[model samples]
Target: MLQVFVFNIPVESGERIGFSTTLLLAITVYMTIVSNRLPDFSYLDISYLSNFLLSDVTSGILLIICVIQSLRFYHAPVMQQFPKVWVPDLIVGNPYGSNINLAENGRVVQFTNEGEAVWQPANVFEMNCVAQIAYYPFDMQNCTFGFLPWGFGVKDLFFNVVSQELMNIYFSPNGKWEITNTRLYSQIFYGDQLLRLEFTFKRRSRYEIINTVGPIIILGMLQVFVFIIPVESGERIGFSTTLLLAITVYMTIVSDRLPDVSYPDISYLSYFLLSDVTSGVLLIVCVIQSLRFYHAPDSQQFPKWVIYITKVCSKWKQKVSPKDKQHINDEQIVNSDDIHVPTASEEEEREAPPINWPMISGCFDKICICCFTCICMIRTIVLFVMLTM
Candidate 1:
């Protein structure tokens, strides 16, 4: 007797359909709320956006899987009714594709291209359990080695229907294994058990070192320039400013490369922070020097020779103090305003050899000029060397 029946199936289970609608509605509401609160890219707002994107992607993948599973099951009865034919359609190899069996075992189960068994096994020991599977090619001590067995798990591998019982054996000399597929290139693991994958260590190239350490060294050198230059003069400020600009550009590049992860130790950010502080200090010193020099008078209030003679006398005094001296040297300082030179009227009456005060003034002027010129020349040479270096 043949039986015929007609049945209608629901497109989606009631519970699943309701849940999908509810989840979509909830996400929509959440997105709306997020958009309302965080209008701009404030740090807090960016976090919300990131979370939203991740959540949406996860939900979308879940929904797609659910839809695919539903469609696959809808055609289940039709597939079950058909008998399997092993014609070895090389164009479409296996029903489950290459992933049907572990690569360690050959995929040809019982058939060949001509629908005949090449060699029939009479009660051949069948592998009914998988103790472990691992993917390995992991770096041990910075060296990557070929994959070794890392994991095994207990799994029931179905044998021929005629077999009586499965024997849980540990090791066998005649155990046969085959590689179903070969991966052209991948991070090889020791074996397909533990998830440890390894890669070979490559020697650090000069370009890599330059990219990593060059900026810091260059910036450090620039800072040394500012440090050696005297703050009293204006050169330090200009050099510091240039360094600051360089750091600013470096900071921008660093910020672009670095992710949002916050690092605790000295990082690129810390370098820029230090440079900023140093630049600020140099600028402050420059301002002070400028003010000091701006307020300083061009002409000396007292005789310039007094300042020069006092410095020379102080050096001599230090040397003489260390030695035993009997004479008490008396000294007095006379400025241009205080000098009492003889007038023409006073000189005419003097019978003794007349003194020329103007000549004395002229001699002091020459000495002062020479000292000033020497000081300028020395300072100029030092400044030039610093700038060039």
Candidate 2:
């Protein structure tokens, strides 16, 4: 009865355990009452006390066993080969189950059957990293591979910080993949003393393709300007100008997403440098084009500055040709002017000054500049965008 009341059981299961507990409690209580009433209850009373002592010993032994079992379930190793107590079920590429930790840091928690502490292991190396190793149990395709943003380390400044997304991954070459695909959604699990990196993988899909290819296409279109239009034309200027601005805008966005710190990983910092350098090149070309247009020659050769400075003297000394004056003076003049051969001095002034850059190779220079600029722009954008994604 005492066991039943203490344990709060209704005596089901044909009243087996519940009946025994009730009977034991009844006997214990009866003996206690009799021993208290009979001061000299001789051997019978002593025997009753001995029985109670045995019962107490048995209960203590049972309690100890229960505690040990609880500890074992909570902390004992599940698999000898894999010593880790908190290994997730899906790290080896099994489907189903979510250990996706969007936070930058994660924890591996272990609990026994009775909700007891086993042991927690924290780590940044997920199964995905092992997949890149090309070794047994680790060399599996469908792994994580991509560039990390530079600001990832900021979390380590004073406290733990988790990455908002899993941007870094290396996909397997066996099949196609989509950029939007998130094979390992929960990469980290927060813990008291450590962060755990849970490894996960998923099949490639169409979503990833659209997300990845879109940026490539955008960068590619910018490159088309170099090939389709003349470097010196208005079209080239407009296209490059727009592209340069776009690159700058994207760079700013990317930079903001990453951590702000002096030490950035190659993966994140590399993209920033590439975008900046490319934009610089494009802007420089823009300035050069502006100068070229401002100084464009009317007759393929610039006039001497001396002529402009001495305009009054030039007007008086260089009177209009007799034939030109005759035609201008009388609009009805129909007589054809007799041809007059010009002397050496007249011929010298008549012929426009020989085109200045006769040996400059302007065509080659323009084409080279355009080609170089386009290459840099395309390479920078494509590399950074693809890897970052």
Candidate 3:
């Protein structure tokens, strides 16, 4: 009965499995009825059945045939005849235009006999992010990458992450940015399910500090030293102008590293720009201060305040003579010794000169150095507080 049952039935696939099983049961019953008519059925040679059913070679060949038949049956035209809903997997590609990330292969869709399909693609992507440089080297940024089916709504297709911790393994360390946090979420956009992955990154400031910002700060501080150049030496204007130009060049270099955004975020570059403008104004003041003491006729006396400040600055360097003190008191001094001052030709011939500009320039330098120092300090503190918040 078992031999007849095994020989009458073949392996079944798909919807035909139930029919094949019923036919095998009928054959088993028929074989049992026929065996009852035989006398001495106990002596029947059943040993030969082992060669066809249980031998290793026969079993191996049967297993191989079953697998091949199953594969062929699964892909047969009968299976394809059933109606199927097609969906596509959307894989995100690199948006930052960075070459460090791996390329994205197309998505794969898998179907089952029960009319269900799953779409999954490798989630390797480096998306574009808009940089807010208002805080620049100290800024933080949020970037997102997502997938959605082109034509399917939530009813026809749905999305999910294979594992929530997948990003933890795939994230690559970057030299300029540090990943601070990550989130995976889904939302409906125009009735379509959109699965998104977001990463929040903070700027790694060591590189900018060393290469861009450090040099800018040094250049700004150098502007303060411009005040120390003696006005009479005729180097202050040239020095201040050169320093201003240097700052402009530095600003250009730093700006090249920043993104163009519509809104102002607090950026270190803004501080550099403000500092550079302040330096330019200071340079103008230096030029004007030098001009104040440049050349004056002996009859044109110094302003009372100018003389007072100049005296205060030069107290340690030179003594205030009785005549010089009297000139400060009167605000007008005609040196009797110069009553018959020479013509232009005679003045040119005389070697000795009067009208001290160095003292005036020195006084102006002291005032500017204090003002510029205060401005720079205040800006630094404000920027630090803003960035921290």
Candidate 4:
């Protein structure tokens, strides 16, 4: 119920998601081979990569990642003779990796008379990558899987990408991110040939938009309504102050989500929040101005500028449209017989009260409500446009 009241996102009636072409999920791209540094050989296998842990994927700790891989080798006659060579070792290709962790230690799987061998084992690696969060919530992350021969240098062992196709047959899409693109390439790194698989993922923005941005925009527009609340009710300051505090709390929430980085990069969200805070402060100023005018003693007569403004506004108000004038005339003509002429004393008694500070304050309230409401709404629309960009 709290979620529905505070953060529910309403989708347009005709909104829909459509895909023009069928695409596969990421194919598992895993390789952890270890053995005696003997001869350069080509091995072929299909890898399955899944279970992306995004919560702690940042640089808070030097965490090690583990992957299970299935390996296959063909036309290796010498491996059949030396069963001792079948032993699996260690390999860490990630540049930020600290060490290699081994599990199941590469046990021999199958051997055929045709000189084909299979080994399946668990490979663990601890890696640390610097996070780029300047565009958070609307950010795209680039993660890579780089694997190469550990025992042999580029001169002895060669690596190549047989295909750049990522098999998506066994993978599920992430709830918060979508894989935008992928790349495969072979490169020589630190004298070792490496096969690198790169993944570009973009975050889904619906959560932040509905839960954070929506509230900011709504509260921003709501600030203007403080003027509409009658000052006589004594709720104007309380309402404005409460709104200012709410905006401050949301500012903290936005700040907490951002990382403290050594470099300078500002999120566009910061701009939106800054505008909201400014409006809140301005709202308090406006409220104070309105209250001051309302409470002023009648002895403190209106300034010349104030009197002039009210005179101009009254003149403008007296200039009625033709439709209103005709309606008034029709009513008067129909009720001519019922209308009783007022005496001079009655006219004097019915005269409007003298122009006072309280009446002027009411005028200022209308102006502030219209002006601030327009500003808040215009900026909110701009925010939506920028968010899409």
Best by lDDT: 4
Ranking by lDDT: 4, 3, 2, 1
Residue 94 error for model 1, in Å? Answer: 28
TM-score of each: 0.27, 0.31, 0.60, 0.60
Task: Give the TM-score (vs. native) of candidate 1.
Answer: 0.27
lDDT of each: 0.40, 0.43, 0.62, 0.63
Model 2, C-alpha of 371: deviation from truth (Å): 3.3
User: Which of candidates 1 and 2 is the stronger one according to TM-score?
Assistant: 2
- Please identify model 4 stretches exceeding 4 Å from their true place: 1-136, 145-153, 189-194, 262-264, 308-354
Greater lDDT among 3 and 4 belongs to 4
lDDT of 2 by residue, 1-389 (tens): 23334333332333434444555566656666755665665544566565675575466445445444544554556522324344322222222343333223333455544555543333343333322211111112344432222223325322233464545555454454233333323232232122232334433534433543345336544544443464446465556566666656655654564335443233333353455446556555644544463456655653454233234333433455433533355555545576576898786467533333321223324444566666656665765454545
Better of 1 and 4 by TM-score: 4
Residues 233-298, model 3: lDDT tens digits: 777778778878877887777767776555645465666566667767766776675566655445
Q: Write model 1 residue lDDT over 120-214, tens digit each, in one string.
A: 21221222221111110110112221222223321212112233222325434322232122221223223222212222232322442366335
Clash counts for all predictions: 26, 26, 6, 6
Error of 2 at 358 (Å): 12
